[model samples]
Target: MKKLIRLFVFFLMFFIPASRVCAFSDGDSVIKIIYKRSYNNPPFPESTNNQYIIIDGNKSYCLFGEGVRGKDGKIGARVDLMKDFGNHTLYFMGPMIPEYTVNDYWSDSLPAMHWTIVNQFTTIKNNYCQKAVTNFRGREYTAFFALNIPIQDGPWKFCGLPGLIVKLGDSKGIYNFEMTSFEKVPNEYNLGIGKENGDYSLYKPLFKKWHLRRLEKDKARREADPNCLDCGEGVTVRYTFIENLLD
Candidate 1:
């Protein structure tokens, strides 16, 4: 009976199509994503440097955003994509560097999304495709995909679909993202949740009182300031909308 079961399993494994193998397990992998930003009101559309997102299983994701406008370091956010538990962005000053602290609670997620196919002939990486749409963060985006690669993962917090998200952007024609190429994992990559024996399972606490107050003050100041640089007085403000890969 044992021998029969083993033989049946072996036969099934050999019969599955090669394309089905693109459905990756929940293991670790390093992916490279090229990002670009644009502004409709100001009419400045340009491509910027690429970034990296390392999926460290269920605990963490390391996002390395680079380019003239991007932060130069990697931010180790949770798999949920919220709460700055590590030293990333302006939240951590020089004195706070090298120290790790978890935020009060995590509130972000790349939730399971519902996608309706728009078309199936949109070319991506020269492959036959299916274009679909989904909404996130108060915005709706049309994404082009190909079912040949069955993995639900893609750049940024984009996930949980029938195929790899090759490209996506808002419907009003604001921001856009697309896959450039694929490569071997970098040497600096790590598969562990914390990359080492450090922050995983144990994180220092961030004082909510001080942190929340600071965040509120910062928001108020930003709202008061008119961020438009050279625009005329008639224009209230010029907004630079960023398609946060971390979102």
Candidate 2:
């Protein structure tokens, strides 16, 4: 498997058609939450990335609002992270390289976040929210959840709360996610990946163990290549992965 992945890394110029991965079609998206995500990846602080979370009946999909925005300002079909609370499963898809157009995905059981709801209270976007804390993956997080939302989920692997998390930030203050807007979709939305008729068999399944391994290889490549254009002279390079790679 490692050899296969290494081959893909080097020979990725050869096109592999992406598979059409479908989202739950049983229900329409009831609500969508837009989050203003800010994080520090070292060498850079307070980096901003917008994220969106769409809630269906018993499933939710969270994805970056990068390539999925249409010219009409509506969301296009794309799925980055999907949570199926009913099945206790999660599907993580990412690193959408335009050259390969290969849909890379991985699946694992939902993480068990033992959140402790606190007595403290606050309001976010006019919603009454309460404080909750939990140790997820490797970081301790303080989250503010909206009681009125009545959804047990949030941005980026935060769930098991009594309501939707309105704001989340790690203890180190390196990462912060806050809900900016919430709205109900006027029509049905199907979260999907790749073209409609694309071959699902071509989708690559990435194992969790290989994630760090791949990163290390890329790091070595970058370090050895003095001509790497991403880094200029005197520019300091550092990496701070959002989640513990080991987890």
TM-score of each: 0.51, 0.70
Residues 1-247, candidate 2, lDDT per residue (tens digit)? 9999857743432222111011223344356778899987565656787888877767788865633556676566667777888888766664434433436555555655788889998777767678999887688999998766666778877788877788999999889999897776533454654332212123233224445566677778877986888654766656566656543
Backbone clashes in each candidate structure, one number apiece?
0, 0
TM-score of 2: 0.70
Q: What are the lDDT figures for the candidates, one per model?
A: 0.45, 0.67
Question: Model 1 over residues 93-203: C-alpha lDDT tens digits?
Answer: 111222423322223334435667775556677434578878765568888765555445555556666665677777876666666754323323332222222231122
Residue 136 CA displacement from its true place in model 2, Å: 1.0
lDDT over C-alpha atoms for residue 123 of model 2? 71
Segments in model 1 whose C-alpha atoms lie over 4 Å from true places: 1-47, 55-62, 66-105, 191-247
